[model samples]
Target: MTSVPHVPVVVVGGGQAGLSTSYWLKSRGIEHLVFERRTAAHVWETTRWDTFCLVTPNWQCRLPGHPYDGPDPDGFMKKDEIVAYVKGFVAKVAPPIREGVSVERAFRRGDGVFEVKTSEGDVTCDEIVVATGGYSDPIIPRMAERLPEMIVQMHSEQYRRPEALPEGAVLVVGSGQSGAQIAEDLHLAGRKVHLAVGPAPRCARFYRGRDVVTWLADMGYYEMTVDSHPLREGVRDNTNHYVTGRDGGRDIDLRRFAREGMELYGVLDDFRDGELRFRPNLAESLDFADRTYNGINAAIDKHIAQAGVEAPPPSVYEPVWRPDAERTALPLDGSGISAIVWCIGFTPNFRWLDAPVFNGAGRPAHRRGITECRGVSFIGLPWLNTWGSGRFGAVGDDAEHVVSTIAARLEGAAPAIQAAE
Candidate 1:
């Protein structure tokens, strides 16, 4: 008779979150294995554009024991730098990882142990930490199919460089972080750019005398959890503030692009009859973004006053440009747009993990990584614990919490193990 392999814990990813969990589990003397179907840098190397950089400063690269050690802690890490950082964490952790081993399915078995089916072989484990970060599948709109066959269309993930695009104006849909940054990339490259703006907010690169992130960190913003948030779980669906770390880290002011030669429109409504349709919400969306920007600044201003901090004289942004007329439509033939980049974002897919832990919207239903099932948990999800949960900033905290929870459960079940023996 053949004996089946078993591990006390199984981590589904080998990224920073997964590696962080491994670090904590190792410290607790827990036996486990991490399954990663690809290298840690695969996503960074493949999906990100050439000029992509972390909008947050390098200081936020807090991967458990391996924090950012670069010379410029305040500066952002570019594509290569970010990849290097993740790889450095993997090297330092030296996690017991099975690379190239795909986790086909994971479910809590009838016996309480988890059966994690993988490309390698099935294994039973007491606990499974799903660290596969939220952004899984690119969300290109269904309207993309109606576009002219001659017009090149690609999701933001596939975009690399402006030179790689067809020669003509490029229409970038969705003005979240990716859209804004990509539009800036093309604009800087002297490409005729058309942007379809969304309600994604924006923040100044530097507010007062320091980075806005630093101010927020000082004000305990990073520590703010889901429970404490005003919007609570709804904040999870909020689009990221559009900013850029391309040059020396700057706010991606879409209005500024409008002031230049770039054309701006409202949210993309549809694509039909050889024309692209837009909702006449350009002015509203821009106002929404500015309000968020000013609102954040206002909070910082209040904090400065109460804390008795001397900083630069506070200032607010006035709209640099407004649409002369809301453009409702643009004919594709003369629009000069030959390529379309969809920067809407992605939805996390947990379909492979056939577990009842998911909510109605297909999101993992858990409080800060702990699921109702004793051994099934999630990590590396936005708002998993705090605003920084999905990023390197607070993944360690989530990882520690998950490992501790599992450890406590094991201790509680120890009597059963002895009884069975």
Candidate 2:
């Protein structure tokens, strides 16, 4: 049997979360190894489409020791710019990162140490940090299988550009940021676009000559926790804003798409014989989105009033609805919709970790990234501590907290191990 190399700590991802954790560990002079399945910032380099740009402004790119200080702080970064930024960070920090090495499985040993089996070899570590982020696996509806084989389907992660898809109308099933952006991309590419709307929140890109994110930060909205927000449950569980970074940051809502000749439908309910059924609540969903959008601006206005900050007049966006156009059922062949883009969302998969670290709902059981099981921690989970916990600008905060906890635990006596009789 080959001997397994042991280390004090092992991080099992190479994205922003993992990199941030590694930066903190290195700062403390802690010995650790980062096993990345691919190269650093693999998601940004590969998963995102060619025209993709970050929804968050550049000023919010707050990796530790690498805050954005460029001339265009308010400008949104494109995909290549983000990849280069992370690459620059890696070059500067030079952490102990092993690219192209994937951790296959991780489990606790009888001696209270973790055995992390990787493609290259096995590693025994005193502590393990999982930084795979919130978006791990692309979530597609089960009914997707029922669609006719003639219809080509792809997830938003796999979608690159309109030319990459078949020559036909596209049905984008989800009104989140990705779906809205992709739909707009397709429309610009001269493809007929049909968008199925959902209960995604929307906000204007800029209000009163300031980016929406700037306003959000000024109002301390990003600092709000899941437990403190009025829509606590939804903030923790729902998809992000249905806005876009395209056109230099602008609102991309169902109304805009509908007015632009893009077909809008309700939630994709089910699939029948050569046809797809949609919910009849298109009007209701649009109303809800508009209310949520206005509510955000209203909060910002109230904050400005209380703080007595000088700001321009707030912009009002009226709702746009055309109930007669929304169809409940459309045959796949008749609509010329040869492709379906499933932008439903992503779900994290931790099956590789053979530990009881998950809750009843199969989510990682952690409070601010600290698990009940000693020496195990999680980072990059949405709403882990606050609204920005999972974002690039705020992931370092969570990483710092987790690293400090790990450092404190490592200073004490060895972890307790239950011996079998």
Who wins the lDDT comparison? Answer: 1
* Model 2 global lDDT (CA atoms, 0 to 1): 0.85
Report clash pairs, candidate 2: none
Tell me the spans in candidate 1 whose CA falls farther than 4 Å from its real position: 413-421
Compared with the true structure, all predictions reach lDDT values of: 0.89, 0.85
User: For model 1, how does the per-residue alpha-carbon lDDT over 5-70 read when each residue is reduced to its tens digit?
Assistant: 999999998888899999999999999999988876688888999999999999998889999998
CA-RMSD of model 1: 3.8
Candidate 1: C-alpha lDDT: 0.89
TM-score of each: 0.96, 0.95
